[model samples]
Target chain A: MKFSPLVDELIKSLQCLPGVGPRSAQRMAFHLLERDRNGGGKLGDSVSRAMSEVGHCQQCRTFTEQELCQICSNPKRTESGQLCVVESPADLLAIESAGQYSGQYFVLMGHLSPLDGIGPDDIGLDRLETTLSEGEWREIILATNPTVEGEATAQYIADIAHDCDVKVTRIAHGVPVGGELEYVDGTTLALSFSGRTAV
Target chain B: MKFSPLVDELIKSLQCLPGVGPRSAQRMAFHLLERDRNGGGKLGDSVSRAMSEVGHCQQCRTFTEQELCQICSNPKRTESGQLCVVESPADLLAIESAGQYSGQYFVLMGHLSPLDGIGPDDIGLDRLETTLSEGEWREIILATNPTVEGEATAQYIADIAHDCDVKVTRIAHGVPVGGELEYVDGTTLALSFSGRTAV
Candidate 1:
């Protein structure tokens, strides 16, 4: 039943991901050794690379490897005078994969839930306000999730953006009521995409 | 939505986990940044610890840190001549957590799936044969899973051990039909312990 410290450590480390229990973690550890030796090797390399290279963008709160995240730095993508605000990089990718919008983003890392003591300041709302005050974006899109906390966040952002010169908008109902975008089927997601009405 | 290369890379890297999709991966990346700033910082450190530190034991095929795994080196663990042979370290841990066994282990690392060309030699069966041939073991318990592939692998080991002078045994009855030991509750697993009948 005993294992080497590092091998044991590796198994424990894999458990940190959501839903992976001890057994799955053990399976994953062995999987790295068995089916995808190269993936295992690549996984180690990637973790180290992302850890050292990727960082936060001061201006937009999204993760970046350089002074700004690639989205904020690039000159080619249609900046379009629109800023889509999201709760995390994951949500950003969900929107990106749909291939709908051509605007930039502001990833809010956390949602505003006061019971958890996550307010505007806790979720970098003040920075979003200051950036909106500068009047760079034509329409500020609130793309937080449809959760209770997310709706509160959207309302909070709407109030702040409305005071600024920017046109306040909450990106509409592509996501289902009480449904996580992660669980939504691709077709439904696409339907939600086409049906997005103004907030 | 347009994103930076850093953003893209982070998402793909996180998707390496079993159940995590692209969206979940994105959320995880953001979750790490927001909630576990210290844990996030530690992730980079743990990646290298796991990567460089883990490797297969030269003797047993079980993962280990040193030249020998902790079990192989320990004096407290049974040197009592019984070897519970399993296909992976995960299996060994499952059996061990039941607090039932007082023997050492010989993990085959994989099963003998002939169609896949994973025969005796391919799955470290050769090493097991040599260990059995040495006549040091009192019994070799074939504790492979109850799945078809696992059954096939177990049969192959039983066949090889048939000619050996030592007693050969197989764990029985506690595991559900077509159920994985990973999913079985600990109490049932313990009951499986008391219920173990020989091959």
Candidate 2:
């Protein structure tokens, strides 16, 4: 037998999360019901509100409830004249957390996948081209994932930036810091060597 | 920078699940926002409804929107006269999935833990006692966990069942099936030996 109808429905609905499966969903449902009803209620309200209200920023396509996201609305960020392109908002946040860049971002939301019929327009490249042409960007940085699709997407965006007369660069591919060279993939090792710079 | 206000709030609220951390919560939030708004909306609605409407089953104390849980309300299950007591609804579901028990269940919601200030009433033991006294139960099956608190709870409930002139039995403790004896803990190995029956 299953949990009561409402409890069962809650469990099934929870499986929409990226990594959640049956057991995890059930545990989450029971945890909310038994221990943290207030938290659960808050979560429900927040999810509903976010789903209905959150929309893409007019400039960069990052998530926001406003017409323009906070970063896009900030004159200082816009004045930085450096645009970083990433595959998702999570990637944008990762770069922000590093505290290395102070530029505006254009979130692709996903890379171009020709096999899946995902093209330039699907990842908002048309908007990226328009921004590149309109903004006084000194440089465009591609920080998409290190995969075939990401490489193709970066190349495509780089061409667009070149046509707009803006310099473009891809984030370096190399053995990650704190990682052993022996454990690093051959392609990454080769790229590290090819892209090496003098100290 | 963090996500926009509503998206950020949604990520934080998603962390209320048992194993979800900041990273997992962010991933979940972005996933729902980008890919599955319908599922996320349904999750929110179900969670809100369940939080507001679901309550303890009056008869067995398991979670249910109705006065009695499905198992408690079913006449066929009630007629079995064997009441299995478990520490949580999850545990009750586990037993039901095993397809071994057909009797009604009494969910304790939690075992007795006095140091944490949880008492009999905190786990609905008063209601359990009332049901035990009022029903014509043939046997009371104690299926609480094997922890110290669980043992204490089972002993306490056993005394109550004894007062009602009902036979009480604790689920056996032993090395788990399919587990190597060499890897089994000494306590479990000893229990396996002590509880061994004639072959």
Residue lDDT tens for model 1, B139-164: 88889877788888888888878867
| True interface contacts retained by model 2 | 0.85
lDDT of each: 0.75, 0.93
The candidate scoring highest on lDDT is 2
Q: B1-199, model 2: which lDDT tens digit per residue? A: 8778899899999999999999899989999999999999999999999999999998899999999999988999978799999999899989999999999899999999999999999988888889889989999999999999999999999998998899999999998889998899999999989999998
**TM-scores of chain A across candidates:** 0.80, 0.97
Tens digits of per-residue lDDT for model 1 on A9-88? 77777666566688777777777665665556555565556656777887777777778766777665445988898988
TM-score of chain B of each: 0.82, 0.97
Question: Where does model 2 exceed 4 Å of error?
Answer: none
Span of 10 residues, lowest total lDDT, candidate 1 chain A: A37-46
